[model samples]
Target: MIARVFGASFVVTILSLVVAFLYAGWSGVALCAILGILEISLSFDNAVINATILERMSPMWQKIFLTVGILIAVVGMRLLFPLVIVWATAGLNPVDAMDLALNPPADGAATFADGSASYETLLTDAHPQIAAFGGMFLIMLFLDFVFDDSGVTWLSPIEGPLGRLGRLPGASTVVALAALVTAAQFAADDATVSVLTAGILGLFTYLVVNGLTGLIEQDEPDDSAGPSEAVKAVGKAGLFLFLYLEVLDASFSFDGVIGAFAITSDPILIALGLGFIGAMFVRSITVYMVRAGTLSEYRYLEHGAHWAIGALAVIMLVSVDENIEVPEIVTGLIGVAFIGAATLSSIWANRRDAARQSASPVAD
Candidate 1:
């Protein structure tokens, strides 16, 4: 099991180094290697969450996520997504945007040829809106989990009440909106439109994903699904889940992409280092978690993952403050701490359960 994990990391590191060296010599190789590790550390929670969803999926869908889905995640989200954002924010045509992206001007210089904004300025300038969107989306995710009307309670003191309140469908939205309002202050006054629009879109993304799932999975009135019907439903249901997973993956990757820029303004290197290589390892970790039944074995693992996400969402929102730069390692450690504590708790619970079972009367 460790070998599987190690092997994946090893292969990804090699690929990252090869790409990095080809691009910017040994320095690039070292930088990309660091970015790869950074990606893995920051996104460990993402892997856990992905595993929770992936384990329930059909084998074929699982493979799809591992293979084709990784490509989309790496190229589409990591590469094209950043470029598209630059184009839209900079208000440039495709060719000009591509040129600006490939050749960013010096800091504070015009990004566009006509002493206009450069890709780095435009991209970094777009951070507040990005943070707002990603932050709102993740907060909604955390809220939904805590507010679930389930009897289970990991952090009962807080989660129990939240679960009760979550019974009201509108509750999560309200909370997310409140978060947006607080985060909006971080955006430049002029960026009000961007922040609000992006934040709302984040909320809408969650709603649409849920709405689609409910639409497809809802039972028909006065009718029961037959075997064939059930089979078709199963396929459709997995598709909804796939959509959810992709959105979730996107949300998780948002901060990573932004952070990658801090390492290097070159989107190509960012794609190779954090996007491509890191994505491969993340997919591998998800598959490993699923196959290992880690969630089932350590029941609190999911809770830890969600909690890590909650922390991340908060950090991302507050990160608009230049004075408060949370170290990347700090972010990674937060998730690791949660998971580590949860693992210990799970072990204790398992042992106690075993003891109780042993003490109970044996059936003849």
Candidate 2:
């Protein structure tokens, strides 16, 4: 089963590589690989969170996530979205932007109507937006951790009581909406607003997708005892699992999709590299967790990832202003630290459980 999954992903990866090589040759291939690894590593926490969501989905949905959803991410978001941005903002005719992106300009100066490159110009022009995005992300994270009603909060020492005070119904959603409104206002004036908007978009997307999914989920009918019934149950579970997986995948891809700009401006390379290679690895890792039922076994892993997501959200929020700067490295490392600690804690938990079982009475 693992081989089949990896094999399929490898095929896609190879196709992406071919496209990259065709566009920019060896340099493009090398750059894509390096960026792919960086994107995957930086998003390890995202993988964990995605697995948690997948565990709750139905099998059919999981398949959709792996297939159709990936196509959207790689083709629609990673490739097309950037092109759209360049076209809309930079006033490049749609065809021209597409042409420039597909066949990059020979010289940076030759790429633009203004004698500058689109990618470089967009990114540089977008520095304020990127900075804004980072700030807003951080703030969203803070609000999430601070306001969560989860039982396994690491911030309980402070949040346990204080959090209780402002815990209103739908507070997180409200804050997310507010963040979005703020971002919309400042998106034009400052890049920070755009960052804030993206974080809000992330939160809003999560809630809407998950909520709709829960409402549509069908309950399993009980049967006296039959293999057929068990099979039906498994099928339903997989469908729901796939839906949740897609939602999670979309959320996790947000940063990496945007962050791909930091690596190279070749939209083709970004989409092919991050969308296919990077995201494929993430999906593989997520599937491993689902198949292994890692979350069921390790209670704190999801918690750690959520905490990290919450932290990143908060970072995004604060980044709206110039008062602070939160590096992507710091954001990623903080997530990694949380996951590392959770892994150790999970091991400790398993050991404790085993010890207890050994000490308990057994039937003769």
Candidate 3:
């Protein structure tokens, strides 16, 4: 099962090597291989979050997520999304953006028409917007979990209280916005407005998506009806899940795209290196978690991942400060630690359940 689940990793390793070899020879191939690992390390928590959402979807949507969604992840985000940023920030034409990507100049030369900031420099300037948007969106997700009293707790002391407060309507959104505003106040004077706007947009995006999903999913049937219920399952492939997954995936990739620039600002390399290989691994992990029923079996996995996401969100928010540099490794390690502890806790929980069942008073 593990081998089958991780098959995509093997395939991606070979593909990344081949693509890198063709693009930049042996040295480049080695770098690509390193990048593939880096991408996975940076996004292990992403797989957990993706699994949480993927489980809500039907089989058809799951397959679509693994296939078509990955392509969009590669082409749309890693490739074109940066170009869109360049266009929006630097006021460059599409052709000019494409040219800049294909042939990125040195540090000082990545430029707008007026040559104020280079392309990469322009991208760095936009990090606050990306951070604000992705951070608020993600922090809201964490808050939603913590706010819900019914859910199992991983960090009960912290989470249990938060979950109780969640009884207040819109508590999560309010908290998230307050955090955003707090971060915005410390932002660069020139960037304060954009940061706030982007943070609000993130909050708005979450509300719209969550509200729309509820509306569409109100009529959907339960998944427990067994295989005889293919009709009901097929109907579950509504646009809401697709949109939700795409937005969720986008939030997950925000850091990777920015961090990719750290490794190599060449957009094409970023596309092939992080986009293809890293994304494929994430898809595979999502599928594996679903097939294994990881969430159901290990109750607190979702909670831990959400907490890790919250940390990531805060890290991103604080990163807007000029002096801050949250290493990619630090982000990855924080998530991995949370997930590892949760896994151990789940194992202990299973053992306790087993012992309780074994020691139950028997019918004579």
**Most accurate candidate by TM-score:** 3
- Tell me each candidate's TM-score: 0.88, 0.77, 0.92
Task: Compose the digit string of candidate 1's lDDT tens values, residues 1-364.
Answer: 8686548557766877887898899988878877778888888999999998886566777877777787888888888887788777877766776677788775535454576777777777777778778888888888888888788767779888888999986998899898888777776678877788898999999889867766765642213555433433346766786888888888888878877767777777888878777878888889898888899998888988898999988887787544466767787899888877777888888999999999999999
The prediction achieving the highest lDDT against the true structure is 3
Name the runs in model 2 displaced over 4 angstroms.
102-117, 123-167, 174-206, 218-251, 322-326, 360-364
Task: Provide the lDDT at 13 for model 3.
Answer: 67
Instruction: Report the poorest 10 consecutive residues by lDDT, candidate 3.
Output: 228-237
lDDT of 2 by residue, 1-364 (tens): 6786678778877887887788789999987887678778878887887776665544656677778778877787677766666775678865777776666555545355556675645544544444343434334444655676655554457657636744787776676667656645544454544555555555655565555555444555324446444433234445554555554555455456666656676777787788888888787778788888888788778767766776666555454444455666787898898888877788888899999999999999
Give the per-residue Cα lDDT of candidate 2 at 47: 82
Candidate 3 clashing pairs, residues 3+ apart or interchain: 110-118, 110-119
In every candidate, how many clashes are there? 2, 45, 2
Ranking by lDDT: 3, 1, 2
Q: Who is ahead in TM-score, 1 or 2?
A: 1
Q: Assess candidate 1 and give its TM-score to the true structure.
A: 0.88
Candidate 3 C-alpha lDDT tens digits along 70-89 = 88989988888888887887
